[model samples]
Target: MSCTTAHAHELYQLYASHLIKRDIWDVKRSVMEQRFQFDPFAPQISCAGIHEHHKILDDLGDEMVVINQAYTRLWPAAQRDCTYLTSRRRVDDTDIYAVINYSVNHPDDHIPASFVRASAEVGMVCESVIRPQCTETSLDALTRQDIQTKIYYQAKISPGGWVPAAVVRETSKREYPKFLHQLGKGCTEHFSDRPLDCSTVKKAFESRPPPAE
Candidate 1:
């Protein structure tokens, strides 16, 4: 997706916000409810050493662990815990932003007997590149309209229970692009006027204690 009125960093922040604020930003159609088993943005650590290696020591970014109750029209409601990593980087004249989420079993997470356990692995990347047509000499003069964003998304999911893996994969192939489109739309609307305030999230990760050895 390309934005005419948002820069790369601005777009990146908005994208990251949707993931970090999952309880607020997740699509209701996909996730019925979400709760953080381990909030990467919380001020206090929930687990002593669970996420020690998931830290953002460089520009790779923050990580999170969450439990979500999700559903689809073809399958019953299912529950899963996932680990997510979100990051941003600059290569040459382009800015690359990415999010990776995969199913993980946490010792602290307990699944209800009524809920089927599901598994998913998803990867999304957005690249914001400066338009070649732009010839602005001053950095301050560069406008948001000068950047174009390209998005790539991939997912593999098994809804568990009676859902076939092939059916799930086929459904994802058809649906994930729509999901990305919605994400881009949300990002554009969210930062229509100003960029997101990411300091709070950044601080939380920065201040977190190292994972236990």
Candidate 2:
């Protein structure tokens, strides 16, 4: 398939947000901090260019905003844990981004830093999976092409490939933002702001008892 500049730009905007929330930056720091014996970097599934290319994607109208918000909501589906940080990297020319979930309870795990680094490399591919379907139900109507065009890249990042800009060609803030804006009773919008921020997004969620409750 062929990609266009518009779609590329939108993807870039969305990806910029993805890296932050996904802890890609933090993951990199963890590797560098540990030094050798604790070899830096995490293992990945593929060396797809998309992982690094996230910072750049088509600027397909306002589609980027929708995908960005979509990613944030679905992050927990695959992430599952709040304490661990994640990072992705390209494996040479292949289209893969090995995912690493760094152990956050370093003090409690009482494991050596080198061990932790080693463990992250092993956990890279297996633990990461499809975007949480339940969370991304709003995109239920998305076509296969749509999946590949918009969500596929970040959902399961890999390299040696590219998504054409035409995929999200029809998307726009006017059309897609409403989906994100409508979720959780607009809680993400906050009391004073026009859009969602870190503080208000999770405010509307109600804690629940377990199965026995």
Q: Give the poorly placed runs of model 1, Cα more than 4 Å off.
A: 1-94, 164-176, 195-213
Model 2, position 59, has a per-residue lDDT of: 29
The Cα local distance difference test for each model comes to 0.42, 0.26
Model 1 agreement with the true structure over 1-213: per-residue lDDT tens digits: 332222334533554443332321121122322321211111110111121111121122233323333322222334333333333333333345566656665554555565565555556676665555655444445466645568776544444444333333344445445546667788777767875333212322334344344
Clashing pairs in 1: 49-212, 52-211
How high is each candidate's TM-score?
0.51, 0.19
Candidate 2 lDDT over 1-213, as tens digits, reads 133455544333332432332322112212223332211322122111222212221122322211111112222122111223334443443333343433233332232222112222223321112222313322233222221111221121211112222222223213233332232223222222432222211211112122231
TM-score of 1: 0.51
The local distance difference test score of model 1 is 0.42
For candidate 1, the per-residue lDDT at 181 reads 67
lDDT accuracy of residue 183 in candidate 1: 78
Q: What C-alpha RMSD separates each model from the true structure?
A: 15.8, 20.7
